[model samples]
Target chain A: MKVTHAKLLAQVPLLTDLPTELLESLAKSCRFEQVNRGHVIIERHDTTRRFFFLLSGQVRMLDLNRQGQEIALAILDAPTHFGELAVIDSLPRSASVQATTRCEVASISPQDAEKLIYTVPQVSRKIMQNMATVIRNNNLHRQVLQQQSISNRLAAYLLGQLPKDIDPKETVCIRNLPIQYDLSILLGTTRESISRALTTLVDEGLVTKDGKNLYLNDIPGLYQLLEED
Target chain B: MKVTHAKLLAQVPLLTDLPTELLESLAKSCRFEQVNRGHVIIERHDTTRRFFFLLSGQVRMLDLNRQGQEIALAILDAPTHFGELAVIDSLPRSASVQATTRCEVASISPQDAEKLIYTVPQVSRKIMQNMATVIRNNNLHRQVLQQQSISNRLAAYLLGQLPKDIDPKETVCIRNLPIQYDLSILLGTTRESISRALTTLVDEGLVTKDGKNLYLNDIPGLYQLLEED
Candidate 1:
């Protein structure tokens, strides 16, 4: 892919204040690959060699138990970066990353990435800023997951999608949200708990459910649920 | 403190690589304060504007529940940085920090910290790297805490403190190690569990306990416990 294509990959908060030229240069060096669904891009404890950016589809970051139960950590969608921590810390992969769908990913080996950063200081700064945002968001998410209860966590998770001071009457479309199983893992709860919470919301008329989709019926009630003791 | 003192402070991994003059300037602006035991420096969700560096003594970072139960997250010791996350993210404090001992600390306002970072690029880079390390360590600790049983966690915790390839016959001192309560929080287990594990080790002649101190008597045994299924 041309370096111009990489320009489309940078998100606002993650790569804020970067010059277009730097991003173009970075995109030029990235090696793009198409991976099938369920393909493992990286495995836990593997040597850290490459950093990957998702161009399309979803990737799941997860850890496996000795008995082979997988605990999903985070899901990386389009325009998101992963495996950078390994490069930064010079450590082995802390978890496994696998394609949840047919994924188009661009990767830069650590050696190449470091060389680019050294040669292009602007790109390095932008990358650092991007990493800082990732760390901050991860920490905030972990904090919410640790402190909030299952129900409150579900409400907060939904509220997180809406803007602060959202209109009470505004109906929120939830069909495009990530998979329920992914949500359950991210919130550190079971799928049954998530389904039950969604059912309760629907029963209370706080949300409307149709097949696999949902829409907010009472945003105020949803907010109240989030605030409940 | 003199410029030399500031330079010495900059020797910390977080501040290393910053310009000497910038370090001197930041040190000059820092306010030195003494905190008595039980003093709260930062409160969870508090909109405080100051950040701290532990110059001497221990400071405990804790998460508080609605019922007012406190869970210790980390213990900040000499020359350690704290409160940088809140400053960087421009968010309310996520955890409370309290003095666990009569200690001297240096503090800087968020504004000044930002100014120093902007003016001294190296300082900003160092700060970013430091925060990254903290995030990585925090995640690793949480993973270990969540996955391991209390006994295994305690054993892993102890084994982590020992040097690799230590002789099985060598006695390792634990007097300077963190207090039991702090250890309990670190391992995400209870004080009773820690006590019981210690007692078991003592009974098996794998460790010796005297007053508040412990000595490792069987390094291989501790490692085996850490590796148990």
Candidate 2:
């Protein structure tokens, strides 16, 4: 069981550089959990400081305002870790983490997480790299929000979600987009605004909506919307 | 001169935990600069990867859209560092950094920065803690933006800038507030919206403004605005 857990943890992107011995030790310190869909994995402002690494499935990090409106922050797929910020800083959870789908996760106690960071060079480097990515993405998101139009922001979002290697002129059909409410929250606009943005995209012949999927009819046109007023 | 640089680096909150020997080595690798007000220290998307430690004065991290509109991200005070993200991840500058006042900064080359992070346990730990603070504050800012009201965001921004230990009932005067345009950018609103929000605050008797200063007549009232619709 310990070996199996260690092997599983070794597959995590954040822990890939960690040595086998360290992985075994970490596996010992971690408590594995099987979370059901819609489970509140970590609550906003909760004092618990455990570091969680998702083994499978997906989760969404969000915050609820005083009016109880959910603000979607990000959705995380498996093989990524969360809650390390609170664990490192000893602060309350910055936002709540909810399982968007059933998930398997491994959680480490605060002491174990601290030990790994303080004693292991690779672990600390990995954490810093991961955090740098988060901060950079957050900065980009801020830039998108400041673009001043829901359609522009939505265009940027779609471009970001698609594979980078896809040719600009090539048509691509992206499936399993988040629901309208989640998209609205992520784009920092109302659901009605999102609907209007989609209509605008459809009218411009840049995108075609088919059930849960969206097809890019003109990828360059979507980019043009972001570049123009 | 190296010893002088070491002493200055020692005072930085991020480097305070670093040992004397590491500070000496770091000082050797760092290039110091004296920047005039409005100097662009780091430009957005610049490929240069250098970690900067601010020795004195203030700098604003901002991004400019294609239309050349500025969006202020944060105003970083002295004794803190920036650009570590680019150094750690070898990414382009996430945002531009401009001196808000005459400033002194020490910069480490990408090689030296990487060496420090990889070899120094204390340095890496401190970076993680600092990044954690940045992420938490970013999360809070996102929540503030999601509040969906310019007044609520402005109030939250004011509360964040003020000293936290102040008594809620005691009237307090906060001076040297950012210019209206900068406030507008930081709160994700327009200057007109910020003016209207300020007017709303005054009409509610929660705040009073004098030229460049703001007086909080009812701190709790501002908090209540955040709590209510």
For model 1, name the residue pairs that clash. none
Superposition TM-score, candidate 2 onto the true structure: 0.90
lDDT of 2 by residue, A1-229 (tens): 9999999998898788777898998999899999999999999989999889999998988876555777788988898898898888888888899998899999999989888767777778888888988887787676666556789888888887787689888889989888797788788778999999999999989999999999998988887887785
True contacts kept of 2: 0.58
Best candidate, DockQ-wise? 2
The residue ranges of model 1 lying beyond 4 angstroms of the native Cα positions read: A1-4, A10-17, A65-69, A115-229, B17-19, B118-122, B147-149, B156-175, B187-207, B211-229
Tens-place lDDT per residue, model 1, A1-229, is 4645656556523343557776676677778789999999999889967977788888988875333456576777776767766776677787899998999888887987656543445555555556556555554454445334576667666765665576767787766666778777666667888888777777788878776677877777866765564
Q: On residues B1-229, what C-alpha lDDT tens digit does candidate 2 reach at each position?
A: 8899999999998789777897998898888999999999999989999889999998998976545677788888898888888888887887899998999999988888888767777778888888888887887676666555789889888887678688889888988888787798788778999999999999999999999899999998998998885
| C-alpha RMSD for every candidate | 4.8, 2.6
Score candidate 1 by DockQ. Answer: 0.23
lDDT of 1 by residue, B1-229 (tens): 4776686557555677777786787788888788899998888888876767777788888875333446677777777777766666666787888898998778888899666544455555566556556666655554444344666666666765676577777888777667778777666456887778667778888788777677988887876665563
